[model samples]
Target: MVITEERIEQALRTLAPVMRRTPMVASRALSDSCGHDVWLKCENLQRTGSFKPRGAYLRIAGLSDEQRARGVVAASAGNHAQGVAWSATTLGIASRVYMPIGASLPKIAATRAYGAEVVLEGEYIDESLTAAHVYAEETGAELIHPFDHEDIVTGQATVGVEICDQMPAVGTVLVPLGGGGLLAGVATAIKLRRPEVRVIGVQAAEAAAWPASLDAGAPVKLATMNTMADGIAVAMPGAVPFAQVSELVDEVVTVSEDAISRALLLLLERAKLIVEPAGATAVAALMEHTDLRLDGQVCAVLSGGNVDPLLLTHITTHGLQAAGRYLTVSVNVPDRPGGLSALLELLRDQGASVVDVIHSRVAGELRLGEVQVTVSLETRGPEHQVALRRALVDAGYLAGE
Candidate 1:
């Protein structure tokens, strides 16, 4: 049950009415920076705020009446849960979703709002999936494997169809790779139609498994997975996507956490698009590896936009730090009141905006009549950061002034 051009076309036809034809947004900034005309395939704006439903809807709609009557069960980190819930409800089928306990609140709420019975279980997607499989077996319900199933991959291939149609002269397409449904589907669809076009899959470097699996010529489980791009943090590759990715994908690459944060910030600032870290992996790949010879015009798929507000704030700050636009400096000052004021005045003269300041005298390292001050300061860029730190040192604030 591998993906085929016909299957993908059928999926596109089936999903057209429910799917929003997300636009190909041109990024002048990225285009100029990368030395190519860059376009963003905004699946982040797709139904359920992701490309999940294209596959979910198609997978569910194909189930027989009896299968549908028994209801459906699924497990996901977040996006796929909402997708399966939305798709099943739209088809008048009862759905139950098992999600990791750490799944974001908004995603859980959205899944429930989509008319699915949401159960919080396990600490990660793999555990939740195990629970979902058990539920399916016990209840005799159909299990909707997020990216592992044939129908799901074929359905996700619709994004490739849209890209092929939208960007007539596209030379390279970069897709965020996780379990590989999107990559497998999109690569197959595009390669089948436009064999000349390059399709690259980008994964979160910390949790990436595809590269090792491809090297071994079989699926390999990661010892540990850690990344902010939770959307693509699969510990192991899916059977279907593994097969598709191995055979069809032109290249598989990785992007760092800092790169992902910077890419997300860039999307928010330049593209005015709110994309989750996982969704921004495609762009991150380009940012981290600028030397890739993407022959002509490039299209990076912004995969999803379901992010927690708290996480967004943290990532934004992290991005700023990674870009050298923010800094946290620790200094020792006199324990007297005027000492802190003098330090503040020095910062003011240096043109650094203080975000936060923590003054403490509790550290064991503190000398007699002295306190430690940790200041979170915002700067312009790398050069400004260097100048500010130099100014702090010159003022003796950094060396116990």
Candidate 2:
């Protein structure tokens, strides 16, 4: 059960044919903002659209002949289900996966396509996990946990080895932490080889459990957790990973939901990388906590990219609003024939792109002859937003945000 340098290398050999050596790309935008050489470990591009396959493959491959015959079962919301399904299919083993009813349709289809019987069970992951455990107990099937086993951690450690091989001089590494499989694995691998390199773990602020767990010297389960980063919203740290993370990880940081959305937006716009919120948490850490002033070459692991398109649209809009790139303003103008026309002219002159407008004359707060107009405008950024509002006020319109 002891994960070491030799075992991690063995994992690389075992995964060579199944997994990819995901690209390590330099990010000019991140580098310029952080004031350091920054690179992105694009595991988002990994098979099954995330790094889950690495651990899933390694764990299932080590099963005994009798165990393989009994098959494997796992519970997950999305990414891990597909990972286990894909890995099991590749190894020619029968696999059954339980997913929460709310799991995205595309993810469910993907898991089924990977040759696993996908069962929709429960409303959340905890319920699915319960069902999976029961199935395992009854059928004598091996239960493949997402991130709580030594074999899983050892498999994930291969990412750290690859990072070191790709960027030999990396001074710091940032990883997204949920149950800590990836963080624990990467930190162990890096620290064992380059003890001087610092490893930081990032988690969604709303779902963070490690800070409290580390303080209590054990895994601590939360009563509730709400975060858009479903991939890293683990309510409790796994016992196996908690042990390694407490010793090998240099620091653990939490990023807000707003920061995660903004980071995802930046990754899409600047780096042209499609990353889920959990994958963007490390980038969010870099965007936030400006006081950290990280030194030397830094690498942030982009954990996964299997985001639902509808969620992507909503988060993109949320990010835009947070960045002040989109604004909604209310104004009262004369209820005349040219009144709305004049307002449109003003917006045109200010170079503001009008996305929506609602004009009403029966508003409760409307004056005797005035009408209320709600305008949704898209601007260049915060500074442009300020200028546009100022222009609205100076132009003799009662503008309010």
**What are the lDDT scores of the predictions, listed in order?**
0.92, 0.93
Q: Write the per-residue lDDT of candidate 2 for residues 271-346, one digit (tens) a residue.
A: 9999998999999999997876465799999999999999999999999998888999888999989999999999
Model 1 over residues 85-187: C-alpha lDDT tens digits? 9999999999999999989999999999999999999998889999999999899999998899999999888899889899989999999999999999999
Model 2 root-mean-square deviation = 1.4
Best by lDDT: 2
- Candidate 1, which segments miss by more than 4 Å at Cα? 399-401
Off by over 4 Å in 2: 399-401
- Clash-forming residue pairs, model 2: none
